[model samples]
Target: MPQLDKDLISQPELWSLVMQLSDRRLTAALLPPVDGEQMILSHIPLPVATAGSYAKAVEEAVYDNPLLLSDFSRIGLLTSSPRVALIPACLDDKAAEEAFEATFGSEACVSLREPTWREAVVVSDDDEQLLAFFRRTFFNITIRPTLAAMIECYRADGLWVSCEDAVIRWVYNLDGNLMAANSFDISAPEDAAYYVAALRRVVGADRGTVYLRRAGASREWCAAMADMLRGASCPVEMVNASPAICRLGHSGADLPDYFLQA
Candidate 1:
């Protein structure tokens, strides 16, 4: 949505800062914003570059602009970013089930199946591109933690964080930013410890914190993991990012009277 686009455009420093926090896609060729209902292909940021035109934008001045204009008509740079999937009740009622072979001026596709209880999958089109993933509310709510870090990056660092379900997250905190992110599997005990151990390996001796969501209902195992971290001297918290910030195009409209009150 343009909401995020506009926000990023206004404070690109935050956007740049987040990359330091994660190994996110490192480039973006800007483009004109697209209104939701427009006939544009899909929900994506950055404009499509012309055929082999990555060469043209390699110079000065024109490349300095935050927005780029070209006539590829079908291919946009930075469109197929590696995306992470999380399980949240936010989109729980969402029933999107279909393997779409879509062409969103780039690449966008998903496998749709009603999540069994709360488990999902995340795939990658490339090491730098998030290919396919699911967001099931009943599963481990990973999006908010990563998203929280993203929002946090917007304020102090341009570092970004995201997950590929069950596996540890890919953190692009900074060149010397030794932070780590992981989406622990909440359904099992062994996996949770394994997740923390993986985190230890990733963050090394850096002062790092672990975040988990208590939404969608988790067992004491999650809290146990938190305690285990404390015993190991790792700062850990069960942070909640529910109803987090309101995203554009989400949530049904409020009652008509609410609008009238204003």
Candidate 2:
């Protein structure tokens, strides 16, 4: 089995993770981000009240039971008040717990973590921001690692990029696991070469990661191209003629089905 690891941005929604499971056997409660709004994918937009409140939001709201599964209408939590399901780390738990007790009178309401920033340039706004955010967040997690250490970590990382007419989408892994995903352009053949160059230049040539393109291009074409990359001293692995990678939406994109196995 592929060793499963969730690329957690913070300990927040439990349902999002459950839904992402390729097995689709698990279920969970979807909690509202600090604002009391439920969001399955995407950042828990920084809370409104204040940074302090945002911090608190992460702590107190997450819950343990009666995991919210479908939309509110489906579950009908409005008719019956079950324990509030919240993001574990969407807010600072220590702070949220203070609010939880102040309001709910205990540390019991908040739940645990869920697996889930900014810019730079080469210089498109999207790519720039994506790369910089990955760099920044990765460091934030590593703390005090020198450039060499960071490079050592990055060299092992990989990502997926595709465009047919404009851009089907692009997704990247900050760590070895899927960490972020996004859509760009529409879809086009032009996107194919552009994305490949970006992966080669931006991600660098040494990662040993594979790139799978779905340009309605031929397998003979893509495979031969992969072979050429090797001739250029670049390591290119498998190439899927189909658009399997793009099917992963927010969670799906970031964490491709059978991605671990790939």
Candidate 3:
């Protein structure tokens, strides 16, 4: 419920840019899942950032130096055994802090900073061995930021849920950064409650929008989700569309980056 203008960059300008950027296609290799396992996380270039003037700002604000000591822990599997990880963007402060703890434990410091209008959450992790190594050589400490910190920079205030093989929901900001994500079976009653609960955690008693993927399987389950959210008196506006399109009655032309083959 707090106003984001004070901590964030120009919301109106960022939203306008995101809308325009969502239309372009990203140039990432489409690697198929190996051994029945798909990569859990991917870093893709925002095609719209290729436009004039926006490129430098996007890189400087959201993608800064790392807060981690080394890549051995986080990217060890990038070449041999990669797994995809999705993080939703629309989280309350507590949820966001908890997520940071999950990754860095007590070995790091988490901080949020906004340059211009884009807010970037950074993690400064200095593992002992790495610190000793750097001090022995350059006499300086090394701090690297995790992907979670970079994603948090998006500062999404809304939630976006969609279904693919199973039910996968992502919290995203209007600027199109996905902050957090979870997957589950929509057919199960417990799952339905879980979905509602997730939304509740994000929106609380406030009104927000929910999107059900426009697949046939999503209709009935999504209807159930809408019903439960309404029952709890949460003013939710549900839309049936590809995750790219969360708002109803849009031009249906733009394809969101999530739908890309990265």
Better of 2 and 3 by TM-score: 3
Task: List candidate 2 segments past 4 Å from native.
Answer: 1-157, 162-168, 177-180, 186-190, 204-206, 213-233, 239-262
Across 21-118, the per-residue lDDT of candidate 1 in tens digits comes to 12211222222233221111121222326322322222221233222222222221221223433233234332211222222223543322122112
Clashes of 3: 24
Which ranges of candidate 1 are over 4 A from the true structure?
1-123, 126-187, 215-219, 242-262
Which one is best on TM-score? Answer: 3
lDDT of 3 by residue, 46-121 (tens): 4345444334432322233121122111111001001123323455556756666676564333343112123333
lDDT of 3 at 41: 21
lDDT for residue 133 in candidate 1, whole number 0-100? 20
- Winner by lDDT between candidate 3 and candidate 2: 3
Task: Score candidate 2 by TM-score against the native.
Answer: 0.28
What TM value does model 3 have?
Answer: 0.34
RMSD of each: 18.9, 18.0, 16.9
- What C-alpha lDDT values do all the predictions have? 0.30, 0.33, 0.35
Whole-structure CA lDDT of model 3: 0.35
RMSD of 3: 16.9
